[model samples]
Target: MPRPRTVLLTGAAGGLGTLMRGLLPAYGYELRLLDVLPIPDEPAAITADLADKDALRAAVHGVDAVLHLAGISLEASFDKILRANIEGTYNLYEAARAEGVRRIVFASSNHAVGFTPRPMGTDPLIPVATPHRPDTFYGLSKAFGEDLAQFYWDKHGLETVSVRIGSCFAEPTSVRMLSVWMSPDDGARLFDAALTAERVGHTVVYGSSANTRLWWDLASARALGYEPRDDSEPYAEKLLAEQGELDPERPEHACLGGHFTTDPPIWPH
Candidate 1:
């Protein structure tokens, strides 16, 4: 299929969403922003929860594709994760199907496989086929999203790219981030690739830059024509100097999920 010109950008007020809002327009995409939170300058944004079927349908209407980035981003209580991530993603897919939007770029997170052991000596790069080992309720919700995308593709013939994003920031902030940080420029490039790739039937790819210390494989993403332009190596010296070296014995450093692995899981009363 040809690249989509008009796309629905959910979670427009969120951090990554806000970044894409400023960048995607340069790629010739007309974005229809949606979020429960009001976008600062986008007065035309669809201000509604994803659970609102009517509003969601309206948001999906006439859009050629959807960039689903809405939902809980952190390790929130299970109830919150269920309501916002699980139910919200389902509602979005239903709306997309009903509105005849075939292509979607789901903003999945590395948390989906957060429990995977970090690479040790001679450990192979983490592949896209890695089994689910979610570290938290938030991570579990992302796993559900991936499966949801797969089901839509199998049953409804919808196309999706579930990007298991690592740390997407301007630069690496910690020693652990050196293996996972994705530059903002590369993030935009990957999303563009995911949106434009042909014949991607619910593909999943690790969303990180071509860092020297990268833990996950980028072959899947590369197959979609995603060529990341940055690396976290340059930031390594400063980060390591400030934060010191990673201690493999620590649970936070022993897994890809970092602090998420050791933090007490939150739950709703």
Candidate 2:
């Protein structure tokens, strides 16, 4: 299939969304921005919460595909996570179905399988088939989103690509990040590939750059035509010097989710 010309970018004012806003247009995508927060310079952006069905319907209307990046991006109370991420995502998909939108690029997360042990030494890279092992309420919400995407595809024929994103930042900031960080440029490339890939029926791919020290496999994403151009190896020297070697005994270092694995549960508070 040809690349979608008009794309609906939810959470358009968030961190990743902001980065994508400036970059996706360069790929020839006409973006219709939406967010609860006001977009700084984009006066035409639809400022509405994802829970608002009517607003969501309006946003989905006339768009060729949706980049579903909306939702709480970090660990939060279960109530908040339920409302913002879970219900919010369901609402978005329902709206898309109602509006007859066919394709979606879901912004899933590595946290969905955060409790899974990270590969050590020459151990094989973690594949996309890994089972769910959510480390936080935020992670659980993403897991639900992936299942929802699958359900939508199986039942309603909606095509989706659920990108289980690692740490996406301008630069790799820590030794641990060296294994997971995805450069902004590679992030755009991965998303573009997901948007343009033909006949994707609820595919899931880890969103990362071609880092030499990566802990996850990119074969699934590569199959979608993603060619990551950046690596975190160059930042290894500085980060390793600052943070030192990871202690295998540490619980945080034991899993793919990092600090999220040992962090206090957010919902009971």
Candidate 3:
């Protein structure tokens, strides 16, 4: 398929969405913004919950693809996770399918495989095909999103790229982040590649920069024309010095999802 010129960017008011808003336009995409919360500067951004089927269908209409960044990002109760991440993603897919939109870049998080062991010294990088061992309801929701993406592809002929993103921040702040951090610029590059790749057919790829301490493989991402230009190496010395290196014996450090694996937040009553 030709390059997608117009995209519906969900979660427009969230941190990653806000960062992407400043970045993706450089690649020539005209973004249609959507969020449950109000977008600060843009008057035209769609303001509605994902459960609003009519609004979701309308948001997807005329857009070439969707960058699905909406939903509750952190660990939440099963009820919240169901409404925001699981059902919300399902709603988005139905809307996209109903509108005849072809491609969607789903923001599947690393926490989806939060219990998988991290690569240690000379250990093979974690493969994209790792089995699901979700540590929290939030992670379980992401795993469900991947399945949802696959079902949409097989049953409805829609294409999706399930990006299992790591810590996408301006800089690495923790010892674990040194291994998982994806710079904002590299995040944009990966998303751009996902948007333009041909015959993706529900491809799942890990998202992060070329970090020296990377725990997972980026080969899948690279195969989609994603050439990451940044690395978390420069931040290594500072983070390591402050927090010290991760100990494999520690449960959190042993897994790819860090604290989400060993110390997930307790669900609220």
Candidate 4:
């Protein structure tokens, strides 16, 4: 198989974005990093807002595929989510379509399926291929992106994969993370599968690891040849003891993972 040559990556300044920028280059993809903030060290970084059609169009120029990571990520006011996540996503899709870009690997979030409940005893509870049950505005935006991917694939023939990413920290920090954390290596592999998978017209897969305590299954992503390495169970004992009490809510305790289903909003402004 021919290697993915040139990829246009957005949101390079963010955590996962930075990791992807570092890893993608090593995987033989000539990276064109994009973000509103300047990343001087990135070889081909472009400073632009994805919501701007003209800027997004310019960013999409001459790229074979787009690993779209740009967007607002918090469960804030509806207006904020609309402009950054919704509109920005639309601009990227339309721009990719116009540029004749064949593939799009979108950075959808676990929050897209956040509302799904998982019982405490079951580790492999929330299967990755399950239907979306978005919990917040941020998650709703991701749901929209997934639908948009379907629209683009059905109407414009653009191959797209919406990866509902879990916690992508350096290490599993809390009890819930034992079920939801996505190691950097696993995250990169997921992106690779999304980029190079054959006949993936439109698909949704969970972005997570092969953890023994994981709440999600990777059958969908397995078809794309993704084999994740890391497991969060190694830190399970330490995390659960440290995190104090687990929430009483079934949605909070169940496989869906995290406070995405909680009453009080937890996103930073």
lDDT of each: 0.92, 0.93, 0.93, 0.83
For candidate 1, the per-residue lDDT at 253 reads 91
- The residue-by-residue lDDT of candidate 2 on 188-228, one tens digit each, is 99999999999999999999999988999999999999999
Weakest lDDT window of 10 consecutive positions for candidate 2: 260-269
lDDT of 1 by residue, 125-202 (tens): 999999999999999999999999999999999999999999888888899999999988899999999999999999
TM-score of each: 0.97, 0.97, 0.98, 0.92
- Model 1 steric clash pairs: none
- The alpha-carbon deviation from the true structure for residue 87 of candidate 2, after best TM-score superposition, in angstroms, is 0.3
Clashes of 2: 0
Error of 4 at 22 (Å): 1.4
Residue 19 miss distance in model 2 (angstroms): 0.3
Candidate 4, residues 81-124, lDDT tens digits: the string is: 89889998999999999999899999998888887766456334
What stretches of model 3 exceed 4 Å from their correct place? 265-269
Error of 1 at 136 (Å): 0.3
Note the residue pairs that clash in candidate 2.
Answer: none
lDDT of 1: 0.92
